[model samples]
Target: MAFFQLWNSDHGHVLEACKDSLKKLQLDYLDLYLVHFPVATKHTGVGTTSSAVDDEGVLEIDTTISLEATWHDMEDLVSKGLARSIGISNYDIFLTRDCLAYSKIKPAVNQIETHPYFQRESLVKFCKKHGVSVTAHTPLGGSAANTEWFGSVSCLDDDVLKGLAAKYKKTPAQIALRWGIQRDTVVIPKSSKVERLKENFEVSDFELTKEDMELIKGMDRKYRTNQPANFWGVDLYA
Candidate 1:
């Protein structure tokens, strides 16, 4: 289990957060710990984390904190036996490259938004080349989330995905997840209902053909439903 920080972590806050997590989970150690996002925010205090924004409602980010420094602190968590492995989330190719070049303890994984709609082939290949595992978040293409946040389309209802699903005797979602697995990333799909959970989990039994895989891959419109830049009022990707 990975303990994600409520606030952007500094050296002191990193240890503090880990201890707090252990106490909450009643676990002495964790198999994996992760920095949830590449960005960090202002530290309110221990036991409380708030996203402090300015008068304009733009987030007041902690410009003082650095990724490499925070990662070093995370590496110490392993030394202290708080976590066995550490990884990062929402990092791009350049940021990942920097971490690979600078760190003594390399990131074990890079969790990012990946689906049939937004393949991000270069970044995925870059991480894989450097021995970093890729974990796909929002793997099924969050239709509800997309409608809520960006008012954009979702891959859940995509024609190609649906067609493949029908051909394979599976759900549209199953086709999306199978496509993700075939792309060589770990897909973390979510569901509120028990049936959906079972549906999402039982994807390994079926396999999409090479032609089907390419068909799904070709559906990439570079359409990003989750846009942190628009949400945060900062273009993190740019």
Candidate 2:
């Protein structure tokens, strides 16, 4: 998979950025390509993410290039065979609905921050209803790294997941992943260690009961673990 970042959201830079990604990845085609965020930022250059910021350090959003226009270019990628599938990321339900309305090729997926603490059930249900798959990016509540970056505690530490883990003889992370999978959402948990990678992959063996799924569902505090406002100086989600 590859992502179209803020700097490459412009109509002219989109194709070049994708080609550049293919060259760097040494691949003939990408299985999936996604717009990293809903909003566009100043075009720094192809293969560059150094989007310009205002004096107050807010990301200089490019209002001239709308997401509808960007989606048209993304659709072109599918037609050109550069990508087998193209999607969006970090989009709320309203933006997602807009994309569905105006898109020639419907978005295949919406990658978003979701976990026990931030289940986002409505968004998940809506996307699935529209034939758009949901990919959970921070499936394990972002772990310790998210705690530092977003100041939100990891959902792995929650009593619900830990209790369920003990019952199933699995790690809290595995329980969380199972919950996401049970909900029909694809999970991408970040891990660097070999043991952790193995642990994360070992979730398919167990399935959460209907009641247990409800327990985790009730654990939702509606808290988002990945907040760009810390660096972007704008609350896009707000």
Candidate 3:
């Protein structure tokens, strides 16, 4: 399935941006289209992700357009057959609840940063309870690249995960992915290497035990790996 995310700067041009993406992909419709973030930023241009920043280098958030209005345009995408499914990303429970209340088409998915280290139990429960599927974006806690790019530690390095890996004869990454799958959240772990891709896919061969799942549950440090604050100059999570 072809999935694409509309950048925050493209909120105002949702229609145009989606059309641009479809055109670039040469597809009549997208399988899934997501609002990259709940917040809106100054419109740079269609198909552009560069955000407008203020004098202090903070992102220039566009407060003029409400998320409700943006979501309305998103709903229009479905009506026009531009996208088959619509969803949100990086949204917390409060924003998601608000969206569910106001949205004509309930969001099919809420993609969030979730892993053993940052198990957002309440948010996951809320979305699933309301019939919206949760997609774990950083399902394996962003792996080592997170540490290199965001200076955040990977959950794969945790001793618990490592120990579990030894017991399951799986890699630490696979153990983490298994934990996410058992939670009923769709896990999308990223890796470019062919071996790593194969390793990531091998999780389906083994099932994490109930006790093992509980052990991983206890690994939650409430730590979010992907921190955009260093670059955005603002903490959206805060």
Candidate 4:
């Protein structure tokens, strides 16, 4: 549902990406389509998405493309019936505000990294207040990415999460995800294990008490586990 090349928003490949995804997915139309990131980069190859980088490995960015222009194309996709809904990802309030200001078809969702560690309450509040639904992408705090990529701490292992898990009789991950859902955000937790997947689905059965919510809220480290700067050389979140 997300295009990889929102970096070069000015090059105008929204239709091509949508069609390519449809063909690959074997679908006639997508339920929702989203711009993966706000930054636009020049295409590295035709019919392929490549992140063009300089010798220093900094991502090549194009400033000529306006988000409004690209968003208009997104609106076109909705009008053309290629996608039922259109949204943005990794956008904070300022960029989201800009999209809302210029958009004829307002964004329905904003997907961002949200978990106990980096709650991003202000941004979530802003989006919800303006009718933008939030989708939480690293609802468990990017444990895999943290361990494999950054060698950083995972929110799932936090003492607070452990305490809550013990209190709720749930896994730490379940508690973290439950907290996010209770915050009125949709959580898309990534897991390959069948049992783990089932466990994630089971969070809807229990509601965290207000006292427990406050306890988990106090665990915010403002820590982001997926810092791609190590490889991309540019911190996209930065």
Instruction: Please report how far candidate 1 places residue 72 from its true position, in Å.
Output: 0.3
Q: What clash pairs does model 1 have?
A: none
**Candidate 3, residue 172: lDDT:** 92
Candidate 3 — what's its lDDT?
Answer: 0.93
- Which is the winner by TM-score between candidate 2 and candidate 3? 3
Candidate 3 residues 100-148, lDDT tens each?
Answer: 9999999999999999999999999999999999999999888788898
lDDT of 1: 0.81
List all candidate RMSDs to the true structure: 1.8, 1.6, 0.7, 2.1
Evaluated at residue 181, the lDDT of candidate 2 is 94
- Tens digit per residue, CA lDDT, model 4, 1-238: 5333233433467788777777877888888888878877776543465577889998777777778888998899889988889889889889999999999999999999889989999999999999999999889988876678887778898898998899889999999999999999999998889998999999988999999999888888888777767766788776
- Residues 122-177 of candidate 1 have per-residue lDDT tens digits of 99999999999999888977768667877878888877887887788998988898
lDDT of each candidate versus the true structure = 0.81, 0.87, 0.93, 0.84
**Residue 73 CA displacement from its true place in model 2, Å:** 0.5
> Number of the top candidate by TM-score?
3
1 or 4, greater by lDDT = 4
Per-candidate TM-score against the hidden true structure: 0.93, 0.95, 0.98, 0.93
lDDT for predicted candidate 2 compared with the true structure: 0.87
What number of clashing residue pairs does each candidate have, in the order they appear?
0, 0, 0, 5
Worst 10-residue lDDT window for candidate 3 reads 44-53
Predicted candidate 2 versus true structure: per-residue lDDT over 1-238, tens digit per residue: 5544324335456788888888888887788888888888887777876657889998888889888988998888889999888999899999999999999999999999999999999999999999999999999989989899889888898888889999999999999999999999999998889999999999988899999999998999999888988888988888
Ranking by TM-score: 3, 2, 1, 4
